[model samples]
Target: MGNFDIKDFKGVIPAVLTVFDKNENIDEVGMRQLISYLIEKGVDGLYLTGSTGEGFIMDSEERKRVVEIVIDEASGRVPIVVHVGAIGTKISIDLAKHAEAVGADGISSVPPFYWKFNENQIVKYYEDIANSCNLPMIVYNVPLAGLLGMNVIKRLASIDNVKGIKYTGMSHYEITQIKDEIGKDFLVYSGCDEMAMSGLLAGADGIIGSFYNIMPELFINIYNAISEKDIEKAQRLQRQAVEIILYSLKVPSFYAGMKAVLRWRGINAGYCRRPFENLTEEEEKEFKEGYKRIKETYKITGVEFLDEL
Candidate 1:
């Protein structure tokens, strides 16, 4: 991996979803199609194999294949940030090295979960991963990783090559504090789709969310609106995004709902892997109806792909 400027990692990065076949295998064709769709829509970056991508349920080989496919499909159009997080440190380190080897722009990992870990252990985990590879590391801050506070974040940020964080929580105050305590160049990406605007206003450098997989243009619009200092337009788009988020939550599975939306868009983003159910026929019908209502209400256009669906 070569030197990467933190500025290149900024903007509306999507925590991309993993496409799977009916047999629960990686759908490479569908995955590439989805990648093309997003790139054509103009996403700033791609976060592969994260929670939205169902990385945890996949094994090491599957994860590596995803990294390879995404990087190849992206074709240097946009930077790919592979999420190399795992329950085990060795696997996480291995994935981190693989990401760098495969030419990922950066690497990110959530603190080891499923077993209670102290702050020192969490700090050490990040330090180990950051040291494992040459690419810059982004600390993923989710509540499941034990609720990292500003103090813990500050400690982790001190590690060399630890560039920034993917903040998924609701605390806008922490976003400001991270930029305040850490440097302004510290890349803070809002992991929550509902708060894309608020996160930007709170000093977040960008956003990475599951919802971006379905409607990336909207989020891109919001980011551009904020950049142009069009607070009114940003707020309007944010409200529409939150409405879609609320409807998405009503589905049986959030990830499944997102995939369903992609399929509706003719992208062929297949179902979630085993242990996670896809939306039922009834749920799909309801979701499509709700989505139609949202599209009409928001006057969202330029998604010519949806017209065929």
Candidate 2:
């Protein structure tokens, strides 16, 4: 893929989950299969090394390996936007350089968290990474990442190397305001799964959802339909997608449900790392029942999500 423009990232792009083996190591085979599955399902790109991918918890070596594995598997078929956000500036720069070296299509970084920083410091932190890498940078602004506001985002987006932003916060109005003030070329993506369509309506370029790892086709279809101005079809698919996620929410284990769903399809994206629990046998059973019920109820057919089965 040659130089992926921010506009080209205007469909569903999942922040894919990182698979770890029992030894707490990257499951290379599982990751490859996961990337293949997503591509086959018609995802526009992969948001590698995000919160869902356990990026913050991973060391620089692990982050580099994940990026390399994803780029190798992508094979220029789909764009891979690597997330190089780390708590430390040096490590984040190291990851960005690695992403550039590995032929990543783009790079994104979350604001430094756990320690409060003034606006100038945040700007410098991002500018440092954006300058270090050749890839266009996407500013990831997740509310859970210590509450940086849109004013800071506008300033950061104005940086020459900053191409776009992944706005994962709950503030739709702020996202709209950012889009309005920043002008075009500043692509903004929704970070939340449930608000995927809502964000699109509010001027988001696309979505970067963890839920897309489990349901790429449906989300991508809904996104495409919405973009084409087919609200009827988009709304129909969005309802079905949300219905399934509701089960994950009700089960009190969304990530666990994701792993179980992946395992059921034999992709082996593996269980999440420690402190993030996997599904029990009973939970898996319930999730399977929920999945089947959703498919049967919606009468879905010939979709990429179903092709995995």
Candidate 3:
């Protein structure tokens, strides 16, 4: 376990992407650069090997290597929460133990998917992982797989080491309910970039999403504005974020579009792996153009842009 408390987990944490080389292997140099970049931009923490990092798509050894690389590169500058979620309980526990061995700050896992799991099974799944190691565990509840209701959330929260949740659903009511049930000290990070403002207002402790990799300063500003009770500024930043997000969706693979933007910034974060196509030449052009417009419209500062680079 790391030295960070639950409070340290609050603020803008990026669900960082996994950089792959031309040969479709994890690019250690590129990954290190990205970790340094986000920390330099003042992101509060890093959520690694999650959906954005394509954790499920990679094998166990690949995931463990990424964790080791990120923790090593971060060098204790910021907390790193590794997503060790796998399809089976044994694999998940193995990953959790490995993360603890490598000195990760925390561990999180999505509930078992693909087959319908009863409430008991879900609770047990989380409990098994949480008990596997000393690190605190966060439950990932996204709407795509299955949404945990207030009752289930309360049950999960009751587990001693089950610390908080990464909520990716759209319901603001649920966010409030989780806080109300678990108390405000229980961390609730907004998993969707599009609803970050709404999530903060609904009492989320912080924001966590793939988009933070693009412009972390903007997201940090949003969190700061919300903390200062500056609703107008928060709304403005969120609108800009939403604009970029909408444009990103125009591409076939949103992650690929993000990688393109990074490459344009001179980061050389390589292509998405197989099954996720890279942006077409035309799509790349459109994305770059739109990204420029977003930067100018929002007057985003303190981050490198493609054109400026």
Candidate 4:
């Protein structure tokens, strides 16, 4: 995203969501408010336009606009890593170059999706993208398309500007394996929100997840507790984090359900784009009640976090 190194960034960085208006266009106002809320709530960094941010659905210019907005709003307060992944290598390269031109801190991408490209082709894709820009690159290991093998990752890591990874799977053993193989200095961020606590203990340097848009402090506190060697506190916070993820999944769509929660907390988190189903009137009521319990009984955070934002 920038002409500098990634700075070995760590701690909780949300793969921040893209707020869309009713017509499925970017809602810049809501997006800025979300970024301000996260930064003010003590998030270490931000991952923009990733899977949770619906990057693939957006056109090249749309993705670039989101990057510009985040870079403008964050204004160097925290590191900003933009996900410039597109199915075509040319599109991804264009996005990565644009990210650097706009002053983003780093750039990241998921491996090619919807096609079973061979290892060599995949490596070449990353190589081209890395070489296209001066920014440090994080290889996104998302299990949805297919888990990238350690051997493949090793090759990808060998790229000069390829600095780290965002592993979306829950395999801590694999995280440790990557650490042992790649050396401890290589940055590895856990992408599963429910497993944030154990993921840190398993050797992940930090976390990047969707839920952080709602309750960043839980993950941040968990990160801090682990650093302080307070196992009990970390465990308690992890459960609270998981409680929200698990219950939120009970709705029609976790993506839409999460936006619903943000609206309840007064963030104007807006709606998920098409094919990511929205909640019905009945489902909306159900989710609202669920959030009330989370706020009062479960004490889900961030309702009070928006005061300054």
Write down the TM-score of every candidate. 0.95, 0.92, 0.95, 0.93
Taking the tens digit of each residue's C-alpha lDDT, what string does model 2 give over 239-289? 777777776786655766687778877788887777777778887776777
Instruction: For model 3, give the RMSD to the true fold.
Output: 1.7
TM-score (C-alpha) between model 2 and the true structure? 0.92
Model 2 lDDT on a 0 to 1 scale: 0.82
Judged by lDDT against the true structure, how good is candidate 1? 0.88
Residue pairs of candidate 4 with colliding backbone atoms: none
lDDT of 4 by residue, 106-196 (tens): 8899988888888998999999999998989999998876789999999998999999999988777999999999988788999889998
Report lDDT (Cα) of residue 145, candidate 2: 74
Stretches of candidate 4 exceeding 4 Å from the true structure: 1-5, 293-309
Off by over 4 Å in 1: 2-4, 296-309
- Candidate 4 displacement at residue 170 in angstroms: 1.5
Name the candidate, 2 or 4, with the larger TM-score value. Answer: 4
Top-scoring candidate (lDDT): 3
| Per-residue alpha-carbon lDDT of candidate 1 for residues 67-148, written as tens digits (9 for 90 to 100) | 8998989988888888999878999999999998988989999999989888999899999999988899999998766679
Writing each residue's lDDT as its tens digit, candidate 3 over 34-118 gives 8988899899999999999988889999999999999999999898899998879999999999999998999998889989999
User: Each candidate's lDDT (Cα)?
Assistant: 0.88, 0.82, 0.88, 0.85
**Higher-scoring candidate on TM-score, 1 or 4:** 1
